[model samples]
Target: MPELPEVEITRLGLMPLINHKVSQVVIRNSSLRWPVNLALNSILKDMPLVGLQRRGKYIFASFPIGTLIIHLGMSGRLCIASKKSAVQKHDHVDIIFNGPENKILRYRDPRRFGSITWTEDDPYQHKLIMSLGPEPLDNEFSADYLYEKLRNKSVCIKNAIMNSHVVVGVGNIYASESLFQARVQPHRPAHKISKDEIKSIVDAIKDVIENAINKGGSTLNDFFDVDGKSGYFQNEHHVYARKGMPCYLCDHPILQITLGQRSSFYCKNCQK
Candidate 1:
């Protein structure tokens, strides 16, 4: 699934489509995770996409009338397509813009797990996104706030941080890398971690996420930018997917364990 960095990259790459009027919406196949609205054409007709932004993993294409929310589920991607481009298999939604450029934003998802939804009201208040945790890179996700959130929580540190309510966009791959960088064992109880250690984890989370974004995000599976560019962050990973390999810091072998049904890679000698 595309995480925060990948989503942000998608948003940035699609900036050219912003401020363009929606001439038409072509829903080739509406049977996504949630049905693509059949009335999108009528709803978005002539509405200019005034703002393009991302929150967590969702991209919000804002217009004066309302906003269109897009989630690139487990295997979804948006590409800038020409007006005359051929329609391929699994091509779902197409928002054709009315401008001199004559461009189209095509959404393709092999798994059909993505969604395209619209709301006339504030999208931030929508039930789908209202309950989400603070953005990991924002000021609300500070070490003190994280400490307060984890207090008395007996869940394992990895699971706790991975919790959407605790911090948004800390996916399995980045979580492992962040914990490894923070020198904390993934299975350690959240409450057992000291405040100093929590601070380190907080810093590690921000550093790991920023670094991943700088590298265009990890291309573990089908992740790609809006321009079909591959992310190279996976190559710089310290422990993720290096299960039995030698640790980069210490000579001890990196270990892999299953926690919360997700594979966690860590250096036993380096990460305590």
Candidate 2:
């Protein structure tokens, strides 16, 4: 699944082409759980795209009428391509723009988990966006907020941070990497962790996310930038997916554990 950094990077990549351009919205395949074409066409036909932004893992395209909210579920990605290019498989949604350069933006989701919807008043009022916590990069997600949220919580630190209610878009892979960077054991109880450790965890989250954005996000399989290039963050993994391999820092065997049914990787000697 694409996280916040991945989604933000996509928004940035798309802003130049789609912003201020009148879009020709086409929802090719909307037969999924939620029929998107009808809603998308009805709302986006004449709306000029004002800007592009992200909240958590969702991408928001502002328009005159409303906001277009996109969620790249487990295996979904949004790509930008030329209008004349031959459509690829699973190219569900296409938003074409007749700019001076004549470019086309496409949304291709092979797994069909991605979705498109429109919101009039506030996108957050939408059911999917309503319950999400603050963006991980926001000031609201400071160390004090994290410490207060984890107070008296008995869940493991990894699970605590991955909770969307605590903070958005700390997915399994990034969570493990951030924990390892902060030297926090994955299985440590949340409340038992010190305030200093919480601060470290907050800093680690920001650091890992910034690093991933700089690298264009981890392209484990389906993720790609507007240029259709894979992200380079996976190359900098400190502990994620290196289970049973030598830890980079301590040379100890990198360990793997399951938390909240998600596989977590950390260095047993270095993290704890």
Candidate 3:
């Protein structure tokens, strides 16, 4: 699934659509994770895209009528396609822009797990986004906040960080990388971690996420940018998916375990 960095990249890629009026909306299929609003055509026609923003793994396209919330669940990708471009399989929806170039924003999802929804209310207060914790890259996700959130939690450290309510956008891959960077064992209980270690974890998460964004996000599976380009951050991973492989730091073999039903990788000798 595309995480925060990937979602942010998509949001950035869609910036050109801002200030452009929607000419038409073509929905080939409405059977996604949630039924796409069938009235999208009428709702968005002639509406200018005012802005594009990202929160967690969701992208918000702001317009006068409302906000279009998009989630690239699992294998979904949004790409810029020309009007003349051929429609390929899995091309579920298209938002044609009213411009000389006649550009189109196409959504393709092989698994059909992604969603496109509309909300006329403040998007931040939308039910899907209301309870989400502070973004990991924001100052609001400080060590003090995270320390308090986990003070009484018995969940594994990996699971704790992966919880969206604790801090948003730290997915499975980033969770392992962040913990490895912090030299914290993934299986340790969240409350058992020292305050100093929590601070390190906080810093590591920000650094890891920022670096991943710079690298275009990890392309371990079907994730790609709006230009159909793959991210190179997976090449820089420390322990994610390197199970049984040698650790880059201590040379001890990287170990893998399952926490919260997700695969977690860590260096036993280095991460304690």
lDDT (0-100) at residue 207 of candidate 2?
A: 92
Q: Please provide, for model 3 over 39-114, each residue's C-alpha lDDT reduced to its tens digit, 9 standing for 90 to 100.
A: 9999999999999988888999999979999998898889888977889889999999999988799999989999
* Best candidate according to TM-score: 3
Candidate 3 residue runs with Cα over 4 Å from true position: 217-227, 230-232
Q: Give the TM-score of candidate 3.
A: 0.95
Cα lDDT tens digits for candidate 2, 1-272? 77777777777777666554655777789854466857666566666788787888888888877887888776677776775578877888888776666566788777887788777878878888889888888899999999999988999999999989889989888999999989999999999999999999999999998888876634422444344643334567888888899997779999888888989998888877
Cα lDDT computed for each candidate against the true fold = 0.86, 0.79, 0.88
Pairs of colliding residues, candidate 3 = none
- Model 2, which residues run further than 4 Å from truth? 37-39, 217-227, 230-232
| Cα TM-score of candidate 1 | 0.94
What does candidate 1's lDDT look like per residue over 1-272, in tens digits?
A: 77778778777778888888989999999999999889999989898989998888899999998888999888888887886788888888899999887889899998999898888899999888999999988989988998999989999999999998788899998899999999999999999999999999999999988887876633422343344553334558889999899998887899999999999999989988
